[model samples]
Target: MQIDSTNICERLCNKSIRDISWLLNIPRSTVSGIITKWKQLGTTATQSPSGRPRHMTERGQRMLKRTVRRSRQLSAESIAKDLQTPCGLQNSTTTVRRELHGMGSHGREAASKLYITKCNALDAMV
Candidate 1:
């Protein structure tokens, strides 16, 4: 169980914010802020941060994965083109490449295999 500064301040009873800061080895501003928050909001928990939303949704990601799996040879431009209609959104080739990279697909072509039978080797030697 971790004890927070709010609990420490509450336990101090009539102790000054500076006293709490000195005894707890915390900054006076931090001690004062915690006490102020407890008095105002009745809790010392931090609020969640608001940030920008994603450009692509979960469905868009799934569609991209399915398209890549269907044709490993497709370039990022072609994949982005295909995604536009089905996913109902437009993404740049760079974005598609980035998404593919994030999904652990390097978008590389399959390696070609060379066949060399015994007869072929003998013919090459001649």
Candidate 2:
């Protein structure tokens, strides 16, 4: 259900905040804020939330995509090094991982290097 303030305001003249909220299916707090702003500025809030600020530009993202597409098996560190060397965008390994993940690329799995050293000398005491 879409709420159109213009239509609702036209339908209900001199409606209270609660009335407006109930009719429009919006939060009463939001309606109150709107009414307060309307009283002071004669308009409602219009600001929209922009997504997280981009650390890299569109050109940089394109370059990164190209680099990853060229070498599917490139390590995160290697990719970061390449980016820093050619473009001087020296981002950390974590940042590179995030960028690749954002671009719909799969993260390379790290090979497990677990090792065990038996302590036979310590067992001799038992």
Candidate 3:
């Protein structure tokens, strides 16, 4: 198990914060904060962080994947247009490109060959 400052504080319950900090090699303020948090919250665990939400939903991502699978040759601009029209998602080409990249799809197709050679006689001699 992890040895947090709380464990250190619990072990040296009668010791001062500075003494615990010196023994554990932790800053006094950090050790004090952990002990304070444990006393107040009854746990040393951290809370989840809050952040901005995603621009695209799960359904929209699925629709975008389906559209890309249906037409592999579609450009980012065309994909954005299709998303706005049929999929009812109004995202920019850059956003569509970013999402495609995030989904492991670069929207680039393999080059097609117009002709094939059976053998190269000169290469065989070399």
User: What are the per-residue Cα lDDT tens digits for candidate 2 across 4-98?
Assistant: 45434733586776777776787877667666666677656566678897787777788889999998898989888899988889688788888
lDDT (10s digit) by residue, model 3, range 26-66 = 78888788777777887778877789777888988999999
Candidate 3 weakest ten by summed lDDT: 1-10
For each candidate in turn, the TM-score is: 0.55, 0.57, 0.55
TM-score of 2: 0.57
lDDT, model 1, position 63: 93
lDDT values, one for every candidate: 0.79, 0.74, 0.79
User: How does candidate 1 fare on TM-score?
Assistant: 0.55
Give the range where candidate 2 is weakest over 10 consecutive residues by summed lDDT: 1-10
Please identify model 2 stretches exceeding 4 Å from their true place: 1-13, 41-43, 46-52, 108-126
**Which regions of candidate 1 are displaced past 4 Å?**
1-39, 42-51, 111-126
Cα error, residue 123 of model 3, in Å, equals: 4.3
Tens-digit lDDT string for candidate 1 (1-126): 133554455556887877777777878887777777777887778877779776778888899999888978888888889988865788888888888889899956679987999999999999
lDDT of 1: 0.79
